[model samples]
Target: MLFSLIAFLGLIAGLLYLATGARPLKWWRPDTLVAHDLRTLPYMLSYPFEAPDSRQNIIFDSASAAASSPSSTTPAPATQNSAGAAAAAAGGVATPPNTPPSASRAGSHAQLVSTPSSASIGTELPGIRAASLDKLVQRLTHHSISDANFAANFLMTYRAFSTPAELLEKLIHRYHVPLTPSSGRGAATYDKDFVHPIQVRVCNVVKLWVKTGYRDFVNNPTLIARLKYFVALMRRTGHEALADAVIKSFDKQAAKFAADEAAAARLAAGQVVSPASGPSSPASSQPGTPRPGTPVAGLPASAPSTPAHGSLATAVAASPAAPTSATSSPAILKTPVSRAMNAHIPSRSPSKEEIIASPIPMMPPSDLVADITSFLNKKQGSATDRMSRYTAMLCSDSLDALEIARQITLVDYELFRAVEPVECLEQAWSKKDKLTRAPNVLAFIKRFNDLSLLVVSCIVLTPDIKARALVLRKFMLIAQALRELQNFNSLVSIVAAMNSSPIHRLRKTMELVPEKVRQQFKAIEDLVGASSNYKQYRTRLHNLDPPCIPYIGVYLSDLTFIEDGNSSKVEGLTNFDKYRRVASVVREIMQYQDTRYNLVAIPAVIKLFSPDVSDELGINEDKAYENSLLCEPRAAS
Candidate 1:
């Protein structure tokens, strides 16, 4: 037993010796040498002493070793003879005369990292025993790679790998794989020789993702983002389609996310889960439709027909009977992922039209309120700016009308900033003939007009643009808002139309208030409504003529005459008698170029009556017709 104990102790000691470098058993250590080398083996090995961090200590070792032993490797000592030669020959390295050469820099480190070249196989390791290979390996750095994987792999590589070509050539031999040489152009192709086996593996990955889980994906954008970079790599270095495949794989992932969410949501909602609809409906079949025999869920295209309508659902419903021939298990399914994943997936969200019609923050307080007012009040001297003032007054909230207002002012300020209205020519061009740019100009005008109406009614109502223009910028709110009193239906419409009409804002202002208001107080409701309607009456309206009310005029604002309801005036109201008289004068003196479009009375008559065409007209037609004729454009009082 004592002898056996000694023998056991001896074996243990031997194993311990093997474990640690009990003796310097190896001729050369690849790893230690590699480490020692990188520390000093950088490319610019021998730089000037003045150079920062010069590797002189590592580089001059060769010369020192030579001095120590005159019989050192290079007996001729030619390498040491050339001192400054390193700058030109070694690309700017300068070894001192007494320092040791870098062992690692001499290519030993590289061999340690990778396989030794064919030239090294016959060469002996400095002192390693072939019998000790196993023991040395135990002490040497254990391969990070598992013995089970790629342990025997013969790497294909070159000592001085200058370009991708050399790398490819080596890889072909090492992997025993064939590859087609690229043409001079270097564009990648999918020829038999060129297709990377790894790429095939990537394709296989894609196939696996699709075969088992196609419908589970909803938003594939993430997947797209991921595979996209790889695919791009392929495009630049490999085949376009392979890159495309990577991109498509991403698309699939994104789609999967979306589908999963949608399906989960439906499942949660107790609704039916179905295969993805095609592109048109997201539920519609996809374009480049797969043939009837195309495989899905690992079922061969020729497999027994499962009804197309519900095959996937049926298979998923029965997890047990589902085929298991796929390369991998279904990716870990989560409860439906967050909605964010559907961002790239098209079908999961609401349609644009639906979104538009839905209530939204489409309206906001008008920021132009003060701006337009300032522009309006700044008017030096011009009636032509009336439209500018008008639009500014009307639509502080409306982008379209304000835009129109902006254009008119911009044109005016740019061309005739200091010029008065009359200085500019009238009836400047042919009717129905727009200047080359006028159509675009007019279209913008129309857009602003349209936007104005919608914006105002938006009930995100702000004060009128004209009032803002006048108040904020000293711009005239052109004219006051068209009254809602009499013919409110056309009031707003008229304002918009007048701006767009051939009549300049200043010229148009003259026609806005009928004489019935200027000389006398009359309810404006009798003739015009809103400025918008006023415009409509001029352009689109018909069958609307002066009513047979004997009232003198229509007063749109305050300070008009009270109706016959009482002898005394009521608070918040006025009378129309004075307008009746002005209506007579206006009827006799003025005539609109287009008589069909003119209002019966002047703007002055607007202050008296409200527009509802109230029962203020006395129960006497003769009196009413007389006044009506007085207000009429073609008739005399």
Candidate 2:
């Protein structure tokens, strides 16, 4: 193709030389040729979604206004198509041969869809062969779906400091209040959450008979059953007000749990090294010590503004205890970075070995098992004092190291399940120890995570203190529910009491993200990188689904509160990354016409972009309105 184009240009050059006396193909300079090709290339477009009735598609393209009168030539309803000509004609308007394609575009950090494909499942998606993944999305978002406020009890873990997996065990023993089942409607009628789609429900029955129960089918044909159990792991961070299954004694239960853990850590301190003698080898252990547990009493109350609070101080303290055996790193934490992550773990609860090896393995790793041992071996103060001292010694500003260290540590408690003994972090729950923990220890650990998150949240969202504070209150509750996850079972509903906290609303979207994206784009990254350009886009999402950045939402909410009087030049947004994301979501709204904002609510499908987006999109305002450039579309998305 390139050779032919060059030859054609050469022929044109020869003709010019013969007729007009042009000496050479100067127009064919590499830069000129490249520029010419770019200018002449055809525009690209796509249509990622098509409504059930072509009329709906017409409405999006402004056919109602274009046609003027719907009653004059109103034709019978017709099937929907990407072109949507029938819809236009039905309203007495001639269909423009080319309709602007509502195409899906590429997403940030596009990752593989983990669900089993239809071919792998041996057949098409049952009950909802409706081309769009929207058909199978669960619809637990009815008016009755509300979050119950459970944020105040346990700050980090729902069962923090509890010996038994109280949360999981509850799921095992309890019966979830029944949800409204699928209404035997078409694929156009559902959503994706606790509520099951009609198709999925039917497929589950078939899967039981063919794949698990009867084992009679030749090849497994039910995709629903193959849908990983991970789908069931839904969270609601936007609503801190709604508590689905309210616990009666949450605060009391949590306080008791905290007390027990504090005592145990105190005992560990006493047993490891007595205060009179100090640590066995303090000089050898803390190689680069930074004022272990010493007070900076003269400083003001607001002095400890480090990007991260506890982890680094621990890392500095644990320098001598770096785990030696390679196996100390979980088999699941296969990445070298994940292995190196253990170097700066800050606060892990109770303490256990195999506990960290579960679902999300290797969170908030400290220097290593060896590092943790050494830190503990030479430590002489209470855990909170150690943490407070560490907080004081940190650099006065946020940094990459602080954020990475914080996230890695959080990954352990919030996600990873440690397989090996991590006495510094994990704790094997015994009925006995659950009763003896110090309440203050639980508060310190929980606060450590919360404060770290707050710093990062400031980076991701509004720097306003009030908003960050409100969001934080809600996030703390979500962490409480998670604390009880070890006892999680199929029988219990994992709904957090839906609080009004907007952060609670977006939890589902944030939680199940692939481990890699989660690690990189955490609270701190979001605080710093969620620039002004991304706010409106994110706000649209928060209104739609609050948990978009649940963890960061807490901190941003807090920052909003504190900086009500601050004056900063808030930059405006022009990039389409956030808008593009919102566009895809609008399509999802279109899928189920019965949503809070039905398709009819969209008066005009305006492709909003600042003047800046226009340049990148390669078109002017007039042309851009009637066109959207898209190169790819996802069948699942």
Off-target runs (Cα >4 Å) in candidate 2 are: 1-533, 536-637
Give the TM-score of each candidate: 0.16, 0.20
Highest lDDT, which number?
A: 1
lDDT of 1 by residue, 79-129 (tens): 222222121122112211221221332111111111122222211111111
- lDDT for 105 in candidate 1 is 21
Query: Per model, how many backbone clashes are there?
Result: 127, 122
Q: Which stretches of candidate 1 lie over 4 Å from their true place?
A: 1-197, 200-390, 397-637
lDDT (C-alpha, whole model) for all candidates: 0.24, 0.23
